[model samples]
Target: MYFLVMKMRSSRNILPLLSTMIQRTCKFSALPELTKDRYPNVKRGNYSQIDTKHLNFFKDLLGETRVITDENECLGYNTDWIKANRGYSRCVLKPKSTDEVAAILKFCNENLLAVCPQGGNTGLVGGSVPVFDEIVLSTSLMNRIISLDETSGVLTCEAGCILENLEKYLDEHRLIMPLDLGAKGSCQIGGNVSTNAGGLRLLRYGNLQGTVLGLEAVTANGQILDCMSTLKKDNTGFHLKHLFIGSEGSLGLVTKVSIQCPPKPKAVNLAFLGLESFDKILMVFKRCKHELGEILSSCEAIDADSLAATTDNLNLKSPLEKFPFYMVIETHGSDNGHDEEKLNRFLSSLMEDGTVEDGIATNEPSKMNAVWQLRERITEGLIHDGYVFKYDLSLPLENFYSLVGIMKERVGKDAVRVSGYGHVGDGNVHLNVAVKEFSADVLNKIEPFIYEYTSKLRGSISAEHGIGFRKTKYMHYSKSKEAIDLMKSIKKMMDPKGILNPYKVLPQ
Candidate 1:
């Protein structure tokens, strides 16, 4: 299904067709089921258990080659990124500044020890791994960048950089990084500002709580709190870096950020559309926000079992020719002949009122990265199509894709696939569910019945993926027990020996 596309401008023909364009394993064939043995009532948080004098104080404060007590190099920081949580983390450490992550969180909060705070682990839910053996603390050697005002585009970096290497170092100062993802080549802008990561230009340079603008974190007693403010006007006091953006490292440990970057768009365009239902994908997203106004950026929404789970598990090909729903639409501008004459006068008014039924438009960048690798690699092809679960919702784009058709009829026929894709201009919908294997009666019919139909349509059961460790018991189905008891009294006042990241995002 050509997910949202457009390029028809004819009396006969006027040209608008251009196209072109990971065996990064672990979808678990075995050896995954260990997120504290698949959440057996989550226990184990008494802390302090790294032994050998706390591994000789993290091998004498990050030495012995940045510590990592081998177990096959700490099993890739105790696994994640769609292995469905398997953290064991027996020492990983690496630290490369920010005062060595505040001397390993003030010596793991005076040796109560728990830690976790990894980056580039590319978290999906099990927030940067490490559950029962918490002691990872990596930041991939705090990949610095530290500052690049570019006459006020603002950027600061660290917290192990790498979010497509700061978008190619802010594309040589033309600037960007107002967020965009599909795990930006291995994610990490301090885990995208501790999971405030809303990608694909967050429907035009938005979210990351308004593109960051400050951060420093490090709490659990090792104190570092600098609000790093690169300023977009800080009215000061009580913006305490919004207590670590999305708070998945549980109240602190971010280590440095400072965003607000957006300049790199001197005209770009793309369209890949075909639709039949979902009310023509909300009447072509309200005529692409009033006819590609301000050169829209990303709109994405896909279905057709999420592009047949990326052509039956990642072989990737689908360009156009199947319409049960799809839309990709994108645009960013500064003028390419007025952004291709406002995307060819908004695809000649959707081919004279056809609501973009079929199309393909491009401005070539390898044909717009071959149509954004068909919507950012459909979650690595639904984790190679099987036993996946995913979810990151946010709904209310008219009840967004209606819970992927009520989860394909409440997972009818015991699911081998019940799909959906995301960021339809920020209503966020990465809902997925595959299963050629692994099932506890289809994960008990999709958890809390899809968080009670997304809290009866109030919607937002972990939108940009943050109440980690697999949706921290659906966090009161989207908060409000006085906002989760004021987020557990600010995680017991900045991790009072809860020792950071333990059992993740509170809710225990």
Candidate 2:
């Protein structure tokens, strides 16, 4: 037996890859089937459809350039990132300021017209797009940075600011956004806050619930609710900002956001390891916490099938030789020497016990990023494989990988491949199933089974991805009847008419 470690050549940033993915998602052969037709059970609400009067009102308020009625241009805004959901909205409104958003929502509410608050249109579920003829209220034009307190690192920016753009701006000031995602290239800050996005860095920096300080939202009636508090500790009557944090834009449209950023780490390091089994991966995670402790920024596990998908579909080469499992571990700290030493020691201990079959460690920016691409680009690569059924789950580590094997057995031969990968540090697992094409029979075998099994193990069916249009029916598995009822009450109170993002998040 021989030990084989990999050393990869330096490459440019991840922009080329991100650009390719964005291009692929934008070009559609023909528009996807309308949501209303795809799921006939979902009846359109008794709301006024967009008429000439409505379009004229919007045109007068925001000028013709701001109000988009051209069908060809509106097509891009009507579909989701995965092209899984498409709406039949004939109009898309681009509001440049909070006052404009307020006016649009207020007018729509008064006219009894339902509206969908859209941002970047990168949502995994069908939450961002309209179901029927709801007017598309887009926030892409509200992009402006209100202010940045260098001392406290509190950044207040309009909701339309892109995530990658925010990170770049923060880098110059020695600070960074607490949460990051693969979709950061195109996902908007407002949408990130609305969905409460938890990405690769949640292992160290925590979720948006802690990172986001406050936000300003407009209700269905168009009332501006400003909860923009910069202070970390605000003992007010109610932390009202939370109501919209993960509401998925069903309650209201997020206009602006205030988030607390952490100082950028002076040093960073990554270790890519090859493992033999799931039990060994668990053992490594426990030892990892004990050894790496405070410096560990991320710990991700990708199975052989997942790695193959990236290499085969995306033409990306694996750094190391074939292995049953692969792990990407990263650390961020103030001292370079100290952090690298800790990581090296941790890898040494695992290798001594043969827990890690092979490994490569580095602090070089380009090489580290090249490895990061392997993990971040998995979602994009799988799309090229076939029709993908994605599940975001959180389960006890003891049985984390059990469901993947169970699914492969359950789906049998219809499935082209069943792969699992995600943040092990936090217990969120992304299980993706790829088939040649969509089949109701395959879907029937997958869905209720995945949710039921997750409930049986006392796991969350939706770990970080909030309950959007796709998972509304499965809410019962995760929430009690009382909980769901209470949620409905809150929806009624916040958005009485259900004008904002109808047929999403809440079950009928």
Candidate 3:
């Protein structure tokens, strides 16, 4: 099927197609419904007293096959990928089309039933999962590529479409998504927009605010805001779509997304560099950024403990025999010869200056993936080894690596296993505190201890990850009172009833 999307340049309105077309289809409910089964194992309190009259209306409107209330069927949607936070719901609504979403929201608004929209549920912040037994409006059924314009380099798809599927589809067309993450296979486009996810590619492509052209969302009052325009320059009043980009589903449920695509690089190079001290690591980043210029896509760092975790737990061999810090640098460009020559020259210069202890990578894909796996698998492997207190913070390059030393000192050299790593170019670091087990007393001390030092460094407690329930209290440390008040005002304006993903991103 083909769709000729004529996007308006002056307004938020988007023209889908003059004629209807079939793209892709999945088996799931189209609206809300009720069933005989209840979520007995859910941690939240019972929702049996809540009226399902409006939910029943949408069930009849969407059809029984679309809405699911079976105990086994609803369990999968109840929890996110982390499984750290889980909630119960009597029904799971799977709306396929915008009209169905509108109808469901209208009924929900009338009945005053709490609603939580979820995507791939791979969120680390637990924003995609419910803390209460709210009706989960699962977007899984709405996976479909509505349209793609090669000329404009714009792609539009439904909210539930997985990130990996979008990458594959774009690859087939010789295009690529502007952003990518480790959970690309399971994370959905809508979730990415909701969280404003920052991945490895953010160094080159920037954040979701830059890549996302427009969005279509169903607000709390059942209003359909379609601003899926592909215009490169739109001087519209508010740019309302930005409101939902990082609002974490508290503002509205993202039904569809229109993103700007970048051309696939002709040549890509990845190298793993071992460094002795934090000072030299920053030197390497500076030299690479200046020398490689536009070809330098990313520069990520991994400390010794992270290296040990990945090597021991994930069984990934260490690239260097001994190094306090390791860096994964990537360069992508249109010309293979030019990119390779620039990268080699940069590394050669670094070697002469003693900035990089050891550097390796010959532009081979397999080897590159292997080097990246060291950083990517570290977090995943920590889950099996011990209880991890994860923190993603943004700090100055000078102050970044010192965190490792401070954390180890405070937590004790052996009592706590701390690792610091992340996209160095972006000044975002991912530090994991691995302890044998977790207890309330230990957690209370550990959480605030880390946050206090982080606040001293002027670093964010949660850099890319949104302030979900887990980190809501710590948000005050990062955000200003006025800024936070504005966010609360916006949330109140969009969801006056406070039924959309309540008790999240803000402290009551």
Candidate 4:
């Protein structure tokens, strides 16, 4: 297979053929049926159904084009990114401005109608979609850049602004957003904040809690809470914006965001290296941090099985010889000459000390992107392999790769592929298991075992992905009863009627 892939790489036509084969191999003929019955405990709240009066109110508030009633058109809103969950939302409301959102939510609160605030619909968990007949309030149409203070590097934009578009705008201003993800093209800044999305740049720029200066969100009662302060250091009272940062829209509907953008780096470099084992990978990471210092932006790792899955599914050849583990180290600095020199020295030291088996480093933009594709596209390639059971965890670096081995042994023949990869610099590992399809027996073998191992190691079960509907039941595995009780109290106080996103984040 490797030789075939190498040969195909030599020709352009074969690449397209491989792509078509992959599409066919990964395509799902029909998604698993998802209904309220799947979650036996979550019965529909006693909320009023959408009637002509509600339709007229929405139509009058946001024109006929913005209010969608057609079931076919609402399909996109009803399905999640992984297609693991489905909803039956009958109406999708697109509000253009904060006032429009406020009006809609106010009416919904008065009428006892449940509302699901959606943006981009690119979330892994089923947080953005409705579970039953809740109204889908989409921010897709509210995408507008409101302000950018180039000197201060502060950006204030509508919550619906696409992340990639924000990055492009920042490129013009010689700045960049603190976050970068594979779904940046479709994920909205508002949604990013709502979920506290931490992507590739998280190792360097930190998470949304620090990057987001302020934001304006509408509560369940349609009251717009104005916390949109662009100031970097405002010692104001409660610092309420932090409440909504990772609340998953169960608290409020984020309408606008004020984020602090860091100046874009002048020089960027990436080093893709093949390591003999996880120990070697860890040694390289420690040495890289000591050597690269401030310029180190990202340090990620992928196991051999993950690389093979990616190569087979996407027809992407490994840049180096196959190994048990691979690390993609990146550097960002102000001077190209200094950055290149630092990266080269680090690579030379690793090779000389036998820390790295084989590697390739490049500063070229196109080549850098190609190297990143190997790491960023793993999630995309895994979807084709089979039904993927994904767990994003933050563990002690020593125990990061242990679970993959354990799961492989437990699942035995039932598992097709058990792969591990993620931002190793931040101790976050994405462990994915691919099987032929969803199986109750297979799940029983994996779940409590994996979560128990994670909890015993004193690690977080959810590193970046919020506890959407998927992980709501497992919250106890990571958090304490007291902590969960406090969270429930907050949720109750903020959204007393449970009109906000139901059965998400805090478990019922």
User: How accurate locally is residue 399 in candidate 3, as Cα lDDT from 0 to 100?
Assistant: 85
Candidate 1 to truth, TM: 0.37
Candidate 4 weakest ten by summed lDDT: 1-10
Tens digits of per-residue lDDT, candidate 2, 65-134, equal 9888898888888887776788878999999999999999999989999998889888877888887878
Give the TM-score of each candidate: 0.37, 0.94, 0.87, 0.94
Say which prediction, candidate 1 or candidate 3, comes out ahead on TM-score: 3
Cand. 2 TM to true fold: 0.94
Q: How accurate is candidate 1 locally (lDDT)?
A: 0.79
lDDT tens digits by residue: candidate 1, 170-220: 899898788778778887888878878788777777888877888888788
Which lDDT value does model 2 have at 182?
A: 86
Distance from true location, Cα of 187 in model 2, Å: 0.4
Q: How much is 490 displaced in model 1, in angstroms?
A: 36
RMSD list, candidates in order: 18.3, 4.7, 12.4, 4.3
Query: Model 2, clash count?
Result: 0
Each model's total of backbone clashes: 11, 0, 2, 0
Tens-digit per-residue lDDT, 149-237, candidate 3: 99888999999999989999998888899888888888899999999999988989999998898999999988999988788789889
**Model 3 spans > 4 angstroms off:** 1-55, 413-416
- Report the C-alpha displacement of residue 81, candidate 1, in angstroms: 15
What is model 2's C-alpha RMSD? 4.7
Q: How big is the positional error of residue 430 in model 3, measured in Å on the Cα after superposition?
A: 0.8
